[model samples]
Target chain A: MTEDELGGRLAATAEAAVQRLAAALGAAPLAGETARPARLLAAMRHGVLGGGKRLRPALVVETARLFGRDIDDGHGDILLAAAALECVHCYSLVHDDLPAMDDDDIRRGQPTVHRAFDEATAILAGDALLTLAFDLLADPAGEPDAAIRIRLVTRLARAAGMGGMVGGQMLDLAAEGRFDAPAAPMGEAEVRSLQAMKTGALLRFAVDAGAMLGRASGADAAWLARYGDLVGLAFQLADDLLDATADAATVGKATGKDAGRGKATLVALHGVEAARRRLDDLVAEAEAVLQPFGERADALVAIARFIAARPS
Target chain B: MTEDELGGRLAATAEAAVQRLAAALGAAPLAGETARPARLLAAMRHGVLGGGKRLRPALVVETARLFGRDIDDGHGDILLAAAALECVHCYSLVHDDLPAMDDDDIRRGQPTVHRAFDEATAILAGDALLTLAFDLLADPAGEPDAAIRIRLVTRLARAAGMGGMVGGQMLDLAAEGRFDAPAAPMGEAEVRSLQAMKTGALLRFAVDAGAMLGRASGADAAWLARYGDLVGLAFQLADDLLDATADAATVGKATGKDAGRGKATLVALHGVEAARRRLDDLVAEAEAVLQPFGERADALVAIARFIAARPS
Candidate 1:
C-alpha cells in the first residue's frame, strides 16, 4: 500500500480503538454515583474526547502491532493504557492553562476548562483527571499481569512527575527571557534535554507501555524503548518547528505563542533551517533504531516522518 | 496490657517500622552513575517522616495481625503503603497551606513546605509526592499481585482524588463563614461525609490494603474496612476537638486556627460536648467491628480509643 493509504488505515484503526476505549473507561463503576455530580462527569468527558491528534494512542496501537500482537485481542488493555495517558495529558493541559500556570485562555480550539467552568472546579477537574489516570491503569479488569501493569504505572508516573514533565517545566520557566541573550541562548544540549523530558517522555511511554502489554522482552523491548525515545525527541522538535512556522488557526490551538512569551524552543534557539536539519537527523536516528524489525517497523518509521512533516 | 501500655508498645512498633521503611526507601541503586536529586529526596523524606502519629502504618500492622499474619512477613509492603498515604497527607497539607488555600505558616511545629521552599517548588513537591504515592505502591518488589496491587492503587486514587480529599476541600471552602448562620449549622451528616472522605478514605485504605496484602478475604476484610472507617472519622473528630481546645505547643502545630478562619469544622458546627460524645460512639462502633478477630485486634481497637482521647 502507498504511504498515504497506510497512514489512513492506521488512523482509522486508532480512531476505532479510541472510541472503544472511551466507552469502556466511561462504563467503569469507579466514577462513583453518577447522579450527584453530573457536571464533573461531563467536564471529564469533554476534556478526554476533545479534538487533538490521538498520536499517543496511535503510537501504542502501532507498537503493539509491531510486536505481532493483534490489536483486537488485547485491545481493552491497550485502550485503558491509552486512556490513562490521555487523561494525564488532558489534566496537564487544564492545569497548564490555569491562571497559576501558563494562564492561557484557549486549548484544543475551545475555551479552557477554567473559562468553561469556575477556576476551582477546573483545578479540581485537573486533579480528578490525574488521579483517574492511575485508577484506570490499576483497574483489575485490564492487563492481568501485576508486574507488567505496575511497570506501566511506574513509567507513566515518572514521565508525568518531577523528573520528567514537571522538571522540564521548571527548566522552561527558568529559561524564559534568557533565550535571546548573547551569554547563553539556551545551549542545544539543554534544549534537547528539556524537550526530551517535557514532551518526549510521555510519547516514549506510550510506545513502551504498549510493547510491555504485548510481552515484548529481552532485546526486542530494549529496541522498542530506544525507538520510542528517538521518535519522542523528534516529535518535540517537530512541535517546536510547527509552533514557530504555523499559524494559530492551523495548529488548532495557539502557534507562535511560545516565541511571543520568550519560551525556550528549538526554533527559537536555533533558526528554522537549523531546527529542520536537527529534526531530519533525529528522525533518521529513530528510523535506524527500527531497522532490525524490518517491515514490522514500517508504521513507526512512517510515523516519525509524518510527525516531522505534519502541519500541526 | 492496659490500654496506655498497649498503645505505647504499638506506637513504638510503628516508629521502628517507619525507621526501617525510610532506610529501605533511602538505599540508592549501586549501578546508576548519577545520584538522585538530594534536595528533592530530602523534601520527600521530610514530608513523610517529619512526624505524625504514624497511625496509618500502625493500622496496617494491627490489621495484618488480626489476619493471623506476622507483621515481619509483610512489613515492607505495609510500610510502603503507609509511607504512600503519609506522602499524600503531607502533599495535601503543603498545598492546603498555600496562600490560595488555608495560608498556614506552621505545620508539625515547622514551617510548611511552601513557607520553607518557594511557592512553585512547594507545588511541584506536592505534585511529586502525590505521584510518588502511586509509584511506591506499584513497585514490583513490594506487592507481587498485579490485580490486588491495582485494586490498592484504585482505592487510594479514589480516596485521595476529587470525590475524596479535593471534594471535601471544595465543600469546606463553599461552607466557609456559613457554619454559624441561623439556617442550619453544617449538619452532623455533612460533617460525617466530609470527614469520611477527607480523612477516613486513606485510613480505610491503610487497614484494608494491609488485609489485602495478608490475603485476608470475605468477612475479615469487610470487618477490617469497617473498623478503619470508624477510626478514621473518630480521628478527624478528635483533631477537630483538639483544634478547639488544645494549645499550639501541645498540638505541635497551630491550634484553634480553623475556627478563626471561619472554616466549617465538626467542633465548630457541633458543640464540643456533642463532638466528644460522637467520638465515644465511633470508638465503640470501631471496637465492635474488631471483636470477631479476638485479641489479635486489641492493638487496633486501643489505637481507635486513644485517637479519640489523646491529649494532643
Candidate 2:
C-alpha cells in the first residue's frame, strides 16, 4: 500500500480500537448499586472520550506491526493500554485548564470540563481517569500472561508518573518566563528534556508496550523504543510550532496563547522556522532508526511524517 | 503455634517485606535523576513511606503463607505485588485526605501531604503513587508467568478504580448526613454496601493477588477471597467504632470527627452498642469461614480477632 493509504488504514484501526475499548469499559460490572454517581461518571467519560487524534494508540499498533505481530495477538492489551494513555492525556488537559493551572476555558473547541462541570468535578474526573488508566491495564481483556501484563502496567506508570509527564509539567511550571530572561531561552536542551518527559515518555511507552504485547525481544524492542522516542520528540516540536502558527479554529483549541501565557515553547525558544527545521531533523532520525526493518517500517515512517506535518 | 503467635509472625514478615520493597523501589534505576522534578520524587517517597499500618501487605503475605508459597516464589513477584498494593493504599489515603475530598489537615499524626506541599503537589504525588503501584507489578521483578502477572495487575486495577475505592468514596460523599436524616438512617445494609466497595474490595484484591502470585486456584482462591472480605468488613467496622470512641491522640489523627462532619457511620446509624455487637458478630462469622482451613488459617483468624479487639 502507498504510505498515505497505510496511514489511513492504521488510523482507522486505532479508531475502531478506541471504540471497542469504550464499549468494553462500559460493560464492566459496578461494585454494587450505590446510586451510580452519574455526574462523576459523566465527567470521567467526557474527559476520556472527547475526540483527539489517537496518536499513542496508533504508535502501539504500528510498532506491533513492525515487530511482525498482527492486531489480534494481544490487541486487547494494546487497546487497553492505549485507552489508559488517553485517560492520562485527557486528565492532564482537564487539570491544565483549571484556574490553578493554565486557567483556560476552551479545550478541543468546547468548554473545558471544569467549565462544563465544576472545578471539583473536573479534578475528581481527572483523578478518576488517571486511576482508571492503571485499572484498564491491570485487567486487560483476552487474558495475556500475568507477568507480561505487569510489565506493560509498569511501563505506563513510569511514563506517566514523576520521572515522566508529571516531572515535565513541574519543570514547565517552574521555567515559564525564565526562558527568555537574562538566562537561556529555555534552550534546546531544556525544551527537549521537558518534551521528552511530557510527550515522548508516553509515546515511547505506547511503542514499547505494543512490542511487549507481541513479545518482541532484544534488538527489535530496542529499535521500537528508539522509533517511539524520535516520533515523540517530533510530535512535540510540531505541537509547539502549531501553537505559534495555527489559528484556534484550525487547531481545534486555542492557539498562539502560549506566548500570551509566557509558557515555554520550542517556537518561543528557537523561533518558528528553527522549530520546523528541528522537527524535520527528528523525523529523519526516527526514519533512519527503522531502516533495518525494510517495508515493515512503512507504518512507522508514515506516522512520523504525519506527526511532523499535521496541520494542528 | 497458637493463632496469636502465627499472626505475630506474619505481621513481622509483612514489615520485613515492606522494608525490602522500599529498598528495591529506592534502588530502581528509574528513581534517579531529579534533574527534572525533585519535588515529585520527594513527594512520592513521603506519601508512600509515611507511616500507616501495613494491613494490606500483611494480608498478601499471610494469604500466600496459607497457600503454602514462600516469599521467593516466582522471583519475588509476590513481594512486588505487595509493595504495589501499599502504594495504591497510600495513594488512596493521600487523595482521600485532600481538601476537596475529606478536607483533612493531618493523617497518621503528620501534616497531610496537601498541607505540607501545595494542593497541586499532593494531587500529583497521589497520582504518581497510584501509577507507580501498577508499574511495580507490570515490571518483571520475579519469575512469574506473564499471564499471571497480567491477571494480578488487572485485579489491582479493578479494586482501586471506579468500581471499587472510587465508587465507595462517591457513595460516601453522596450519602453523607442523609444516613441519619428523617428519611433513611443508613441501616446495616447501606453500611455493609459502603464497606464492601471501599475496604472489602482492596482487601479482597490483596488476597486474590497474593494467591495469583502463588498460582493458587480453585477452592483455595475462593476461600481466601471470602476470608479477606470478612476481615476487611470487620476492619472497617472497628475503624468506625474507633472513630466514635477513641481519642484523637490515640487514633493518631482526628476521631469522633466524622459525626461532627455529618459523615455517615455505623455508630451514627445503629448506635454504639449495636455497632459493637455487630463487630462481634462479624468476627464470629469470619472465624466460621476460616474453620475449614485448620492450622493454615490460624494467622488470618488471629488477624481478624485483632481487628475486632484493637484499642485504637
Candidate 3:
C-alpha cells in the first residue's frame, strides 16, 4: 500500500470510528429512563468528536484486520474494540488537559473539556468516558464470547488504570516539579520508563486488544505486542520531537511544553537529533516485528513509517 | 436477631470489609514494575480506610448469604463484590470532597483525601480506586465464570457511570445553584429521581451484585433489587435527617451542609419531621420486599430496621 492509500484508509477508519462513537453515545441513555444530560453529552462530544488523526483506533482496526479472514464481517468486533480504545484515549486527553493536570486550554484546536464545560463536568466527563470504555467492552453485543469480553476488560483496565495510563500521568505530573516535593531530576532510563508507562502502555494495549478481538494466539499475539511496543515508543518519541519542534498551529496544542515545564522527556534528555534517530530505529524495529506476516502486514508497516514521518 | 446482635454483626462485617479492603488495596500494583507510589497509596488508604459504618458491604454480605448454602465458605465472592463496591463508595467520597465539588475538609472526623493530599492526587486516587473496582470484578479468580464477571462489570459500570451515580451527581450539582445558570428548584419527584440515581443506584446494585455473585435466579434477583431500592431510599433519607439534626461530633462530617449550600434534598424539601416519617415508611417497604424469604430473611429484615434506627 502506498502512502496515499494508507492515508485514505486511515481517514476512512477514523471516520467510521467517529460515526460509530457518535451513534453509540447518542443511543446511550445518560440516566436510566432519562435522556443523557444534554450538557454532559455536549461536553463529551466536544472532547471526543473534535478532530484528531484517530491513530489509536486505526492501529486497533489494522491489527485486527491482520487476523480477519473476512475483513468486512469482522469489523463489528474490531470496531467495538477500536471505539473502546478511542474512548480511553479521548478520556486521557480530556483529563490530561485539566486545569489541575496539564492545564492546557486547547486540545485538537478547540477549548479543553474543562474550559468548554465546567471543571466538575470535565472531571465527570472523563470519568464517564473511562467507565464507558469498560461498559463497551463488556457489552454482550460487542464480543459474543463472555471469556473474550472478560479478557478485554482485564487487559484494558490494566492498560488504562494505575499500572498504565493513570500511573504514567502521575509520574509525568511528579516530573513537572509541580507538587510539594519536586521529583529529583530524571535520567534517560527514568524518562523512558515514564514515557513507557505514561504513553506507551495504551498504545501497546491498542494493538494487543485488536489481536485479542481477532482471536490471535501465541506467536501472533507476541509479535503484535512487540509491534505495538516499538510503535508506541516511536509514537511518543515522535510526539516529544513535535513538542520540541512543531508550531502550536501545526501541532494543534501548545508546543515546547517539555522545556518550559522542565519536564524530563527523551527529547529533553537526549537532543532532538538523537531522539529523531532513536524514533527511526524504533520504527524499523516495529517493522521487523511484523516481518513474519509478510505482505499482509503492509498497512502496519505503513503505520510505523507514518509514525516516524508524520510532520505533526 | 436482637438489636445488640445486629450491631455486633454489622461491626464484624465492617471489620471484615476493612481488613479485606486493606489487603486487596495493599496488593494493588499502583503501576507495573514499580511499588505503588507511596504517597498515592497513602492518599488512597487515607480515603478508603477512614472509619465509616461500612453499611454497603454489610448489605452485600447479608444479601449474598440469603442464597448461600454454606455461608461460611461463600464469603469470598461476596467479599470481593463488597470490597469493590466500597472502593466506589470511597472514591465518590474522595472526589465529592474536592474543592471543585463539595469542598468539604473533614469526612468521618478525618481530613478528606484532597485536604490530606493535593487536589491532583485526590483526583487520581479516586480514578485509581474506581478502576480498581472493575479490576477486582474482572479478576479470573474472583468469579471464575466470565459471564458472571462480565455481568458484574456491566451492572457496576452502569451503577457508577453517568446514567447512574455520576449523572445523579450532575443533577445534584445543578440543583445546588452554583453554576452560572442556576437550575430551578427541583420538585419532590425530581429530588427522588436525583437521589435514586445518585445514592440509590449504587445501593440497588449492591444487593443486585450480591445476588449475582450468589447466582440468584430471576425472581430472587428482582426481590433483592426491590429490597435494595427501598433500603437505599431509607439510607439516604436517614443520612439527610442526620445531616439536619446531628452535630458534627456525631455525624463525623460537618452537619447542616445542605441548608448552608442550599442543596436540594428530600429532607430539605419535605422538612425534618416528614423526612423521618418517610424513612420509617421506606424501612417498612424494604422489609415488605423481603417477605417472600420468610425467616431466612431475618437478617435482611434486621438490616432494614438497623438502617432506619442507626445513630450516626
Candidate 4:
C-alpha cells in the first residue's frame, strides 16, 4: 500500500479504538458499585479524551487479528484489550510530562495534564489510568477465559511495573546528568538496554499480550514477541531520529530533548545515517518474523514500516 | 484483655508482617524476568520498609485467621497479599507527599521519598510499588487458582484504582479548596463519602480480601465486608482525631495537616467529642458483625477496638 493509504488505515484503527475506550471510561462505574465522581472523571477524560496516535492500541488490535480473526470479529474484546494498553501508554506520558520528570508542557499538540489541570490532578489521573488498565484487562465481559485474563494482567503488570518501564525510567533519569553529581557517560549497550526497557517493554507487551489473548502457542508466541522486539527497536530509533531532526510542531511534542538533557540514544551515539540504516534493517527483520503467517500479517508489516517511515 | 496486652498483641502481629514484607521486597524479581535496578529497588525499599503501624496487614492476617488459617498457616500467601496492600498504601503516601500534593517532607519519622530521594525517584517508586502490588496478586506460585487470582486482581485494582483510593484523593483535593476557585464547603455526607473511598476502601479490601483468600462464602463474606466497613470508618475517624489533636512527634509525621490544608474530615465536621462517640459506635458495630464467627474472631474484635483506641 502507499504510505498515505497505510497512514490512513492506521489512523482509522486508532480512531475506532479511542471511541470505544472513551465510551468505556465514560460509563465505567466506580468501585464497580457506583458512578465515578464527576470532577475526577472529567480530569480522567481530559487526559485520555485528548487525541493522540493510539499506536499501542492499534498494535494490540492488529496483533490480535493475526490469530485468525479480523477487526470486525471480536471487536469488543480486541478494542477493550487495546484500550487497556492505551491507558498505560497515556498514563506514562502524563507522568513523564510532570514537572518532576521531563517537565514538558505540551503533548499531542495540547497542554499536558498537569498544565491543563494541576499537578495533583495530573498525578491522580496517571495513577487512575494505570489502575484502570489492569481493571480493564481482568474485565470478565471482554474475555471469558479466566486463565487468559490472569496471564494478560500478569504480563501488563510486569511490563508497566518497576522491573520494566518504571525501572527504565530510573535508569534514564540517572543517565541525564544531575547537578550535584553527573551520571557517568553511557555506552551504546546501556542506551539500548534503557530504551528496551523504558519504551520497548510495553510495545513488546502489546504483541505478547495479543499472543496470550489469541492463545498463540509456544512457537507462534515466540515469533510475535520477536517481531515485537524488532519493531520496538525500530520505533525507538525512529523516535530518536525525530528527536534529533524534527521540530516540536512536527513531532507534536518537544524534540531535541535527549540532546538537551544529555540523554544518550542510538541515534545520538551513531549519527543519523547509521541510525536510519539500523532502523531499516530492524524493520526488515520485523517483517521477516511475520513470514510464517504469510498474507495474514500484512497489517503488522505495514505497521513496522510505518514506524520506520513516519516523519515525526 | 487489658488494653496494654491488646496493644502488645497488635504490635507483635504488625512487626512480624513488616519483617516478612521487607524480605519479600528485597527478594522480589521484577516481572519474574529480570532484576530491578539497584537504585530503584532501594527507593522502593525506602518507601515500603520505612516503619508504620501496618494496621492493614494486621487486618488481613487477623481476618484470615478467623476463616481457619492462622498467620503461621499459608503464611507466604497471606504475607504476600498483605504486602501487596501495604505497597499500595505506601505508594499513595509517597505520591500524596509530593510538592504538587500534600508536600510533606517527613513521614513515619523519616524523610519522605521525595525529600529522601528526589521527585523523580519518589514518583517512580510510587509507580513501581503500585505495579508490584498487582504483580504480587497475580503470582501463580502464591494463588494457584487462575480464577481467584483474576478476582484478586480485579478487586484490588478496583479498591486502589480510580473509583476507590484515587477517586477519594481527588475529592480530598477538591475539598481542600481549589486554587482558582475554592470548593464549596463539604457537608457531613460529602466528607463521609470522601473518607470511605480514600481510606475505607482499601481497609475494607484488606478484610474482604482475607475472606476471599480463606474462601469465605455467602453470609460469612458479607459479615466480613460489613465488619471491614465499620472498622475502616472507625480507623479513619480515629486518625482524623489524632490529626486534629496529636503532635508531630507523637504522630510520627506532621499533624494538623487536615486543618492546614483545609481538607475536610469527620472530626472537622463534628468536633472531637462527637467523632469519638461515632468511633465507639463503629467499633461496636464492627464487633457485632463478627458475632456468628464466635471466639474464632477474637483477634478481629481486638482489632476493632484497637482501631478506635490507638493514640497515633
Which candidate should be chosen as best, given lDDT against the real structure?
A: 4
**Interface RMSD values for all candidates:** 3.9, 3.3, 2.6, 1.8
Better of 1 and 3 by TM-score: 3
What DockQ do you compute for every candidate structure? 0.32, 0.37, 0.50, 0.62
Tens-digit lDDT string for candidate 2 (A21-114): 5774466464322233566677777776777787887877777777566656644545666677777778888877777567899877878887
Question: Model 1 residue A23 lDDT?
Answer: 75
lDDT tens digits, residues A7-34, model 1? 7966786676558546744554454311
Q: lDDT per residue, candidate 3, A69-167, as tens digits?
A: 222474345677778888888988887887777789987778899887888888888888887788888887676788988888877877877777777
RMSD of 4: 3.5
What lDDT does model 4 reach? Answer: 0.81
TM-score of chain A of each: 0.86, 0.86, 0.91, 0.91
The TM-score-based order of candidates, best leading, equals 4, 3, 2, 1
Q: What is the lDDT of every predicted structure here?
A: 0.70, 0.72, 0.80, 0.81
lDDT of 4 by residue, A87-187 (tens): 88888889999998999999889899899888998999999988888888888866668888888887888888777888888888888864246777689
Fnat measured on candidate 4: 0.66
- The order of the candidates by lDDT, greatest first, is 4, 3, 2, 1
Question: Would you list the rank order by DockQ, best first?
Answer: 4, 3, 2, 1
As for candidate 4, its clashing pairs are none
Off by over 4 Å in 1: A1-43, A68-76, A177-186, A243-271, B1-46, B68-77, B177-190, B242-271
> What ranges in model 3 sit over 4 Å off?
A28-35, A69-76, A246-262, B28-35, B69-76, B246-263
Considering just the first chain, candidate 1 attains a TM-score of 0.86
